[model samples]
Target chain A: MQSLIVDLGERSYPIYIGQNILCEALIKPFIKGNQVMVVTNDTIAPLYLDHLLAHLSGLSVDVTVLPDGESYKDLTHLNLIFDNLLKNKHNRTTTLIALGGGVVGDMTGFAAASYQRGVDFIQIPTTVLSQVDSSVGGKTGVNHPLGKNMIGAFYQPQLVVADISVFATLPDRELSAGIAEVIKYGLIYDYSFFCWLEENIERLVARDADILMQAIHRSCEIKAEVVAQDEKEAGIRAWLNLGHTFGHAIETHQGYGNWLHGEAVAAGTMMALSLSVQMGWISIEDMDRVRRLFEKANLPVTPPKNMSSNDFIDLMSVDKKVLNGQLRLVLLKTLGEAVVTADYSKEKLMDVLSA
Target chain B: MQSLIVDLGERSYPIYIGQNILCEALIKPFIKGNQVMVVTNDTIAPLYLDHLLAHLSGLSVDVTVLPDGESYKDLTHLNLIFDNLLKNKHNRTTTLIALGGGVVGDMTGFAAASYQRGVDFIQIPTTVLSQVDSSVGGKTGVNHPLGKNMIGAFYQPQLVVADISVFATLPDRELSAGIAEVIKYGLIYDYSFFCWLEENIERLVARDADILMQAIHRSCEIKAEVVAQDEKEAGIRAWLNLGHTFGHAIETHQGYGNWLHGEAVAAGTMMALSLSVQMGWISIEDMDRVRRLFEKANLPVTPPKNMSSNDFIDLMSVDKKVLNGQLRLVLLKTLGEAVVTADYSKEKLMDVLSA
Candidate 1:
């Protein structure tokens, strides 16, 4: 198993990844077991909750499942987790284990962070989107009315167990969604990873074990390094948000959970690349590479036809990245290099939108 | 005006104290007017919200009046604040300002810290308990089923406005509770401050302007220094929890929000002294002086008749100070110095209890 530590001082924790690694022993150190709460959603619980619960059989584990969707990543859905914990009388020592994809992971992580101030929780990420992204960083939270992850904490999980076996159960649509985040790492900071993704897109789409492991491992390394530098999403951590500024706008406009996070990011990344090309930061060839690789991964490369530039800009304003009402866009110079800049002119933004 | 700065790198903020210091010019910079939410308990809003809101006259201010008391300082209460922030279309730029005492301050601070991931919040602390303790620490959170502040964060407020005039309307009982924390500062880290408190307890109980200011300033200094050393409550910052270990048990056993926090803390301080003397860390005469001072200030100097030693032990087991189910007590070695030690024997605890 490969592990990465999110160095957040007292809040530091470890993220572990490998095939067939979700057994109890890996996460026992973090579980305060008189009462344990497992938070997941319908989509995940039916598929993998039993395998996860099998580990908690000896312990007094309470499982609570919410409807699976990004739209449910809000306070209303968060309360469902809390309602169970409260009903079960789960205390500070009651550990929360999030056993699902990013939507479930983010919501569960947030539920742990906010329930009774905070509680211990571990992540058992089932989807690639989660194993490589949400599970690694201490970033956990639900979406606010204004934006996704608008309500959250840089709360690290006590332990993160990413088991590749769970991914076989993921639907094709979900599998493709997860790939968007995997591709994000290459576009933001690792040129070689981008090229690697370009070469291995077919295998990854086919769920080739060796290729998938390599992608998850490398994505986590890049993420772990960025998170180490800015645990609080203050600076370099924002780089991990490549495609997210526009991706969030898409997700919000599409009404969260409607568009899988990875799909939104896939299209958002294409726009970022186009914007980058318009800004003269990257050649058109770079944009084409991103589009082709994303397409090969079965990720959407275009915005929904109904989306207007005006609507996109309005939706983008609510993102956490927009500071003092100025919309900040995360555009790419090339794969493996991303910058969060609002230096682009409206003329450029319009050109990309009008494209 | 007296000000203390909690230098927590990017999270650092200021705590200002004085009479009628609520000028718009003083508060506007910290007020993110895109949306401003003021959280206070029912008891405080009737007494001070109109007066406070009058200051933010030109800004878009929204007031949320929660039920009064510490029992209300739960996720149930915090969600009310978060819900209000969103239901009103408040965005990332929205600022939250906590009003009222520690309960309100802590809940609001947590609300601000978790709302939209985090938002800027200012503290208009009306009660002395908050100004000297909760208001300065950025330790924002609500109570948990098993522990006091078991769920919380070191979320700093943008500015802490301690308008002394709010003291004029304070209930005599509540004022005495605030003094408990004021005296706590003197007992924990500053012998000179203890001497100061010993001499000025009477003037403070009667709410003398000059003496109160001195007490508030000195308390802020001690807290500010400890917070500076350990912003996240990892090391020496634990010392600032002087009477809290015992006090929380009392509050919890009695049912939270039952006794005023200061009243319970006042008794807890006496317990700390008794424990200190039992361990030979504090002198008998010093213990007597501690009791005498609490009496003079009209604060409780003994644990309530209702709670047994087992009750205290059970309640304290979940305290933030308690590690791995073992209790860590903060004992006063000298009138103004405190230490958190796990060395107390069960026999010693029984002896103190039976004594």
Candidate 2:
């Protein structure tokens, strides 16, 4: 196993990445308490819950299985975890283990954050999307019907164990979804990693463990560095949200489950690049590279056909990034750099949406 | 206005205690954004909403008035604030102003904490209970049916403006409830404060502004000290919860609105004294002294008659204070000292519950 630390001072935690390493020996060191509650969803429970339980043997372990899908990420489903913890008499000293993809990890992390006004939680993200992205940051919360991730907290996890072996079970669509974020790291900050992704696209699709491990590790390294400096998105941390503003609008317009989070982000990344090109910040060649990467990963490169420019504007206007009533977005100044600003004109942005 | 700082480093904010200081000049300095959403309940809206609005002139201000009571402090009502925020396009930079008692303050604080993963909030606590306790700490959240404050976060406000003038409009029962917490500061950590309470109990009950200001200021001083050292309730902070474990049971058992938080805490404080006496930490005379203070404030001194020892055990067992499946409680060592531990006999606790 290879380890990288997300330096957050007292809240700093380690992210462990490797193949077939989900065991008690690996997870035990991070658990601060004796009581453990493993939270997973219906989709992920049967596949890996028992393996996780095997490692948690002889500890006070309880499990809560939620229904699968982003649509289920709401206050109602969040209550299931809360109800189980309260019912089983879990306390502040108990550690919650989120043992699934982003949906489960987000909700469980949020549950741990709010349970008794915050408890310890360990993340065992089991999908490519979660292992590389959601599980690494301390952003924990559930979505509101009015907006995605509308209610949440910046509560960190005790540890993150991303076992690449679990990615073998991920659906092709989901694996591609994870790649969307993988490409994002390169497009926004690292040209070499973008080129590395360009060369290893097929290897990643073929599920080569070594290449996949490298991608997850590199993505986490960049994220960890950004989070360390700006843990609360007070400044540069917002750079990591490059395509999320437009992506969330698509997800909200399409309804959460209809389009996966990374799928929406994939399309939104393209929109961000398009906006960059219109502003003369990047060459069409650079925009083409980002598009080709998403296409190569089998990710969506455009918003839904039915969504109008107005729909995008209305939804994006309410995005979390909006400040002082102006929509702030993370736009690429080049292939290897990103900046969050509202410097572009509305007509230019509308032109990209129209195209 | 007298100011005391809750020194939480970067999270630290000032607690302003005095009369008629709720103007735009006093409030505007702490607001991080121009968009302001004032959250109040129906009871407080009719009383102070106009005054709050006058101070918020020429800004983008919105208000959501929830039903007034502890029963309404749930996720549903929390969503009312969220709904209004989203509908009005309130961004993450928007500042949420909580202008009511503890219920409104708690929910609004949680809303700001969770809105787009956190926003700035200012507390204009109209109730003495909030001005002295909840407003000082970063503890913000809503109640669940199974338990009180089962769902929430430790999100702090930008500034706390405790307008003692509002207490003049407070109902007698509410004022008495606030006195319970004031008495708690004396009981747990200050012998002289306890003696002072013995002398000034009638003055506090009569709502003398100068005396009330002193009581609120002293209570905040002790609370701020404890919270600064252990902001997350990992150690000495638990001492501030001297009666909360038992008090939460009373609030949960009687149902939230049935027993005001201070009323239940008043009774719970007495029970804690009884437990202390059983453990030989205090004499019957000392217990009576504590009870007399509650009685003088016109606060409840006993739990509901219907709840059995089993009910208390089951509910307290699930309290936030429980550790490693053991019930941890904050009990008095003497009239002026408190400690939190699970190192007590079940028999003695049962005896107190039965009594």
Candidate 3:
């Protein structure tokens, strides 16, 4: 097992990565209270709920199974977790365990943050998308009808246990979706890692255990470093949103769940790179290299054909990244380095959106 | 104006208590962004919205008027704040101003805490219940169906402007409700303040500005002291919830809005004092003194006739104060000091509840 800490001072916690390590002993130390509520989804419950519960023995345990999918990530569904916690008489000391993908992790973490004005929570991210991205950062929230992740909290979890063995059951499309975020860490901060991804992308796509482990570890390490420097996304942490602003527009435009978060991010990352090339910050060849890598991972490289420049402009205007009416995008200064800026040309942005 | 600080290091903020100080200059310094959203209820909007807006010139401002009452303090109405924020293109830097009683303040503060994963908010608490209690502490959240304030966050505001002049327009019933909390400060921490209330309770009920100001100031000071030592209620902060566990049970049982929070708290305080007497902590005279004070203020000193011991036990079991399946109640060891424990005999608790 490999472990890395997201150093947030007193709020710091460790993330454990390994195959089939979701056992009682690994999770026991983090349980701050005897009463535990494991929040997962219908899809994940059929596969991993009992498996996770079997390990949570000798404790007062309860489970709340929500319907699966990104569309369910709303205040309505988030309330269900709270209902279960309150119905089961979970108190301030009770701990909540999130046992599914990003949607489950985000909602469960939020539930913990607000339940009786905060409680301890553990993140057991099942999908690659969650393990590499959502579960690592303390960013937990449910989406509003108008925007994605519009309502939430920056609540840290007590522990994050990422079991790589779960990926064996992930659908091919979902695996590709998760790699989009894995590729994000490389593009934003690590040049050498991006190069490594170029060489290992094929093995990662093929589900090679050794290659997948390395990618997940490297991705978490980069994320941990960024989050440590900026826990609340005040400064350098904004770099993590390299493709998210555009991706959120895609997700909102398509009405969430129609396109997976990672799929949108993959396509959004491509648009950002294309705009980077136009700004002369990077060469066309540099953009193409990342484009090919995303293609190789079976991810989308462009926005949906139905979406136009108007859709991008309208949706992007409401993004959380927009400050004082200016929309900030994380664009590449080079292949591996990124900057969050509204300094780009509007006409060029229009060209990319129109294309 | 009399000002005191809730010293929470970097999260610290000032509470300004005076008559009609809700002006642009006092509020403008606290607003971190150019965009502002004032969240108030229907009752307060017609009275103060235009007056407040008249002062907030030159900044981009919007208003969301929710229906007045505790019944509306749920996730559904809380969503209206988020909806208004998104509809108006409020960004991460936009500040939310909570401009009503506890319900509006709680929902708005929670909205600010969660909107875009947190933003700046200023508390312009118009009601006495809000000014003396809810607005002073960072405890913000909406109620769940299963419980009252079962979901929320401890999110502080950038500034708090308690305009004592607003009490001129407050109804007699609500005025008395607010004093219940003011009296609480005395019972739990300040014997001198309790004596002062004994002498000046009538003047406060008659809305004497000087006496009301003194009461609000003292209540805020005691609350600030407790909150500064334990911001998250891990220790000393729990004492501030002296009657909340019992009060929440009454509020939940009667249904929100049927009984004002402070009225329920006033009645709940009597129950706690009764329990304290049964436990051989405080004498019967001490309990009667508080009961007479509540009577003078026109606050209820007992629970509803319909509620039984079973109702109290059933509802109190789900309170946030319950730890590890043990229900911890904040009880008085004497007239001026309080302690939170589950150490009292259950039979003794039933004696008080059944009475």
Candidate 4:
């Protein structure tokens, strides 16, 4: 087992990565209060709720199992967590445990942030997608029908326990979805990690324990550093959304849960990379290198066939990335470097979208 | 005009208290973005919305007029703020201006807090209840059916423009409700202020402009000092909620809008003072002093005749003040001092409730 701390002053917490740390006593110290409410989903509840609860043994524990999928990640379902907490008499001192993937973690973290103003919560991510991305960042919120992640808070968790052993149960498509974010860390921030991902993509796909652990650790380290510097996404942190502007449009257009977040991000990242090539910032060969990595990971390298430039424009306008009336996007400046800019030409953007 | 700052480090903001300050350039400096959305209720919209919008002529401004009242201060109605924001393509750079009473302020502050994970917001509090209490502290949220303020955030506004001129149009009942909180600041922290309220209670009820301004300024000064020391209510800040635990129970029991928040708080404050008297912490004369002031302000000094001790206990258990299984109550050690304690005897609490 290895741990990395996300340094956020008083809000700083550690992310623990290991084979089966979920059953370990590592989470005991982080439970600030005697009362614990574990928020999971129907899919993960049947699989790991009891196991997680078993580890939470002497504390007064309650469970709220929401229906699975991003479609359920809305205010209506977010209320269910509040309902369960209040119904069971969970108070300001109670700690909420988010015991599933991103949706559960996001909702539960948000639930913790808003419950009686704010409360403590632990994240035990059960999928590769969550373990690599959502679990590390302090970003927690539910979706609005108008946009993805449209309503949320920058709330950090008490502790994040990412037991990769749970990923053995993740479907192949989901595994590739997780790798999409893994590839993102490389394309946006680190060239060496990008090369390493290129070399070890197959082993990660097969779920090799050590390789998967390395990938998760590296992704979190980069994310933790970015978050520590710019927790609220005011400046440099926007680089982390290399494909998210385009990706959110795809997710909102297709309706949430229809296209997995990382899958949409994968296609969105491709559009960003293509735009980068057209701008002459990076060569076609360099963009192709990142494209090959996404393709090898079995992720979508393009937007949906039916989605048009108009759809992308309309949906992307409402994205959180838009400042004033300008649509700013995270575009690659070169391999291993990214910049958020609204300076790009519209005709060129339209050309890339039409392509 | 008088201005004071709520010193919350980087999140600190100024509170401008004066007559008709809402129409001044005081608000423009606080707006961090070019887009603005003014969230007001029906009652206040017809009164002050256009006047507030006139000051924001150059910016892209939109208005969302919600039904007025505390009953509408819930998650369902909170969605309307988001719907209007998204429909108008308001992005992260948008600043939300809450232009009404506490209900509108709480919802707008929370909407600003949760919109795109947070945005800049300014408060133009028209009601005395909001100008003195909710506007000073960064406490923002909506209510749930099961509880009042069950869903919310501790999000501060960029600026608070408390235009006392608007109170001239307020009803007699609403005027008394605002006095309840003004009386609270005195009871919990300032014996001199309490004495002041006692002597000038009738003048305040008559809505004397100078006297109300003095009361609001003093109340905000005390609140700002307390909030600066403890922003999240971990310790000294809970004293600011001197009557809130019992007050929230009364509000929840009366079904939100049925009881104005300050009126319920007035009654709840009496209950706390009564319990304090029973505990031998204060003399009967001291508690009576407060009771008389509530009476003079046309506020209730006791719980509803139908509400039983069991109702108080059942509702208070879910309060944000409850820690673990313990029901902590804020009691006065004397006229100007308050302490949050779970050390009281249950029988004494029952005595106060049954009375």
Reference-based lDDT, residue B117, model 2: 89
Individual DockQ of the candidates?
A: 0.29, 0.86, 0.92, 0.85
Candidates 2 and 3: which is better by lDDT? 3
Question: Model 4: per-residue lDDT, tens digit, A252-352?
Answer: 98989889999999999999988888888999999889888998999999999889999999998898888778899899898899999999988889998
Best-fitting candidate, scored by lDDT: 3
Ranked by DockQ, the better of candidates 1 and 2 is 2
Angstrom error of the Cα, residue A195, model 3: value is: 1.1
Off by over 4 Å in 4: none
Model 2 chain A scores worst on lDDT over the 10 consecutive residues at A24-33
Q: What is the TM-score of chain A alone in each candidate?
A: 0.96, 0.99, 0.99, 0.99
Tell me, by DockQ, which candidate is best.
3
Between which residue pairs do clashes occur in model 3? none
**Candidates' C-alpha lDDT:** 0.81, 0.90, 0.92, 0.90
TM-score of chain B of each: 0.96, 0.99, 0.99, 0.98
Q: For model 2, what is the C-alpha lDDT against the true structure?
A: 0.90
The parts of candidate 2 lying over 4 Å away from their true place are none
Model with the higher lDDT, candidate 1 or 2: 2
lDDT of 1 at A266: 90
Descending-lDDT candidate ranking: 3, 2, 4, 1
**Residue range B1-355, candidate 2, lDDT tens digits:** 8999999999999998888777778888887788999999899888889988988877899999999999999998899999999999999889999999999999999999999889999998988899989898889999888888988999889899988999878999999999999999998889999999899988888988899999999999999998999998879989989888889999898888888999999999989888988999999999988888888899889899999988998788878887777888899999899989888778999899999
Residue by residue across A1-355, what tens digits does model 2's lDDT show? Answer: 8999999999989999999988878888888778999999999989998888989877899999999999999999999998898888887888999999999999999999898888899999988999889998799898887889988999999999999999878999999999998888998879999999999999998899999999999999999988898998888889888899999999999998899989999999999989999899999998898898899899999889999999998888888888898899999999989999989978999998898
What DockQ class does candidate 3 belong to?
high
Worst 10 residues of 3 chain A by lDDT: A83-92
Q: Per DockQ, what order, best first?
A: 3, 2, 4, 1
